[model samples]
Target: MNLKSFPDEHLQSLTSLEYMWISYCPSMDNSFPCGLWPPNLSNLSIGSLKKPISEWGQQNFPTTLVTLILYGENSGAIPFAKADDTRNTATTSSFLLPPSLTYLYISDFMDMESLSMGLQHLTCLEELVIISCPNLKDLPVTLLPSLSRFWVNYCPKLRKKCSRKGKYWPIISQIPDLDILKAGRT
Candidate 1:
């Protein structure tokens, strides 16, 4: 079913839910109820929502959440970084992501200026896919160690710069099992 707006109170009741999909909720701009999400929650998909994920992280983000899918028209611009002077680029909150997370998909992030510093906390991430974001200049260096699959498509600004040398592309190529997916360079 399509969930446009879920009451904040309902978040507490889904303690055993492993997978959650909330999309197209333009007005959802608050933390998900902390008590409802089970620690073992695995798959999570949030799309077209306005709530900053870092706020949700502070309220007890399920450590079991693995495989996160971020989509929607502006959802990718949630700014999952620490709140500090570094905010000049772009930042969210200081929410910590579970170490068990492996796969992350980001789409429609065309307005993000940069990634959040809090991203370094996720040490177990394996796959990262960024698509349709025309403004991403570079990928976070901290995201390289555990990354196995790397995909970037339809990001014109990022691709143009990456096509050259001496920047982040060289570092990206060194990823152990990287699979770069560009617009047509696949």
Candidate 2:
């Protein structure tokens, strides 16, 4: 069922819920309801959310969450880095990813300019796929030691930086498998 607004008490009542998909719910407006995270939820997919994910703190999610998919259409940028005026690049740090998360897929994040350094904390993350995030320019690959598969599609700037001998190359070179596909190339 699809809803424009999800009541907190109703969500809290679904303790047994393991997976949830919310699409076209603009009323959610970027911030999920506080204290409504289902303890057993393992998979969550949100599409067309306007708010950047930086506002979602660690306490807002369930510890059991294992997979997260975020798809934004014309949504604003994701705050992933803090820029240093002296340097041309931004610093990466761990974001509020759930510890049990093993797979993460982000698509069409129009406002993402850089990856958050907080990504390093996803110790169990095995695969990360980013698609159609055109403005994303950097990745903190060194922090994600457990990542086995990395894929990028439709992100021209990021793909170039991850190229062999590129500035970001050495950091991601150790990953077991890497796929950098051009836009619309599948």
Candidate 3:
């Protein structure tokens, strides 16, 4: 924890601080606060923190957030598209998450290719996990048929576009707990 200057009210006294898991902490670079979070933060796992999350410009998460985890540290090629300084640049950047989400996890983004719809504000997303993100290709095919649980591991182009005749498998092929993990299987 080589913390380098994080002084935005510094967690604001725990008000029953719901699960917060700040990960790897690459020298604890001075981002991670747009305001004091953790006023009942329902479960957040902000990532490796070398000042990515697209420069951490605006994040205010505390609508009792429902389980969000991200562990990408190689810096953003599109780590949920941040840097929205009142729409001043970066191609009208959007995707600011926390629409009272219901579990979202993305891991080890080694230069993400596409999370393209930027999850469209997560519309009560029921559960999504993509681990180890090996050059992830694309998802957010209209949020994967309103996912009731979907996982993709080690993403070799999302295990070849979610296989079974590919091209995203007819939009997650009626997902009711679909899990696609090949290409180094977990």
Candidate 4:
């Protein structure tokens, strides 16, 4: 796709658009303005853009949205567009997430080292899936009580850290359904 930018509030007119996927947008240099998103949009998959979502600053996504999937690149994802284990509280989070989400997926962020930085605000989350983040070193110390299903795959560090006897096991062990697959196998 050759998209570079869209006028502010351009997409707000489409009230019937329930889902939006903005992937493979390497040429996109800017983000959608606060009021530009479709009013009823529910599912959003955003990634592969010039700027990682972590550094997009505070965002105001649709309240009707429930599922979110972010595909990462080899680059980082935080301040200055680099990821780290900041452990900032929900009140000082670097990026804001849609609080109404029920399912969230993060994948392929080779330089990312943590997930807790952006996960604290989701009180309605029910499922979380992480995949292919080979360098990720930590999972949330405490998942929201609403979450019941969790999965991770191809994340070498996570597999080792979340294993039965691994250090982070206790954090994820309480989820009702959990699965961690070996790297390069699935």
Taking all chains together, each candidate's TM-score versus the true structure is: 0.73, 0.77, 0.36, 0.77
Clashes of each: 2, 7, 0, 2
TM-score for candidate 3 = 0.36
What are the runs in model 3 whose C-alpha is more than 4 Å off? 1-3, 7-39, 43-45, 51-65, 75-101, 110-125, 129-132, 135-146, 149-154, 165-172, 176-186
- Candidate 2 residue runs with Cα over 4 Å from true position: 26-31, 50-59, 79-95, 184-186
C-alpha RMSD (angstroms) for model 4: 5.1
CA-only RMSD, every prediction? 5.1, 6.3, 13.9, 5.1
* Cα lDDT of model 4 by residue, 1-186, tens digit: 898865545677888989888887788866553524677989988777876655555455678889988787633653221123454443332444667889988877778777766576677889998888877777656563456988889888878888899987766777798888865422
Candidate 3 positional error at 57, Å: 26
Over 1-186, each residue of candidate 3 has an lDDT whose tens digit, in order, gives: 776655546685778878877778787775654545868879988777777766665455777889888887776654354323345343433346666888888888777778855576677888998888788888778767888889888878778889898998988878889888775533
lDDT of the candidates, in the order given: 0.63, 0.69, 0.73, 0.71
- Model 2 scores worst on lDDT over the 10 consecutive residues at 85-94
Over 4 Å off in model 4, which ranges? 3-8, 33-36, 78-94, 184-186
Best by lDDT: 3
Superposition error at 17 for model 4 (Å)? 1.9
Cα lDDT for residue 157, candidate 4:
81
Positional deviation of 49 in candidate 4, in angstroms? 2.1
Sorted on lDDT, best first, the list reads 3, 4, 2, 1
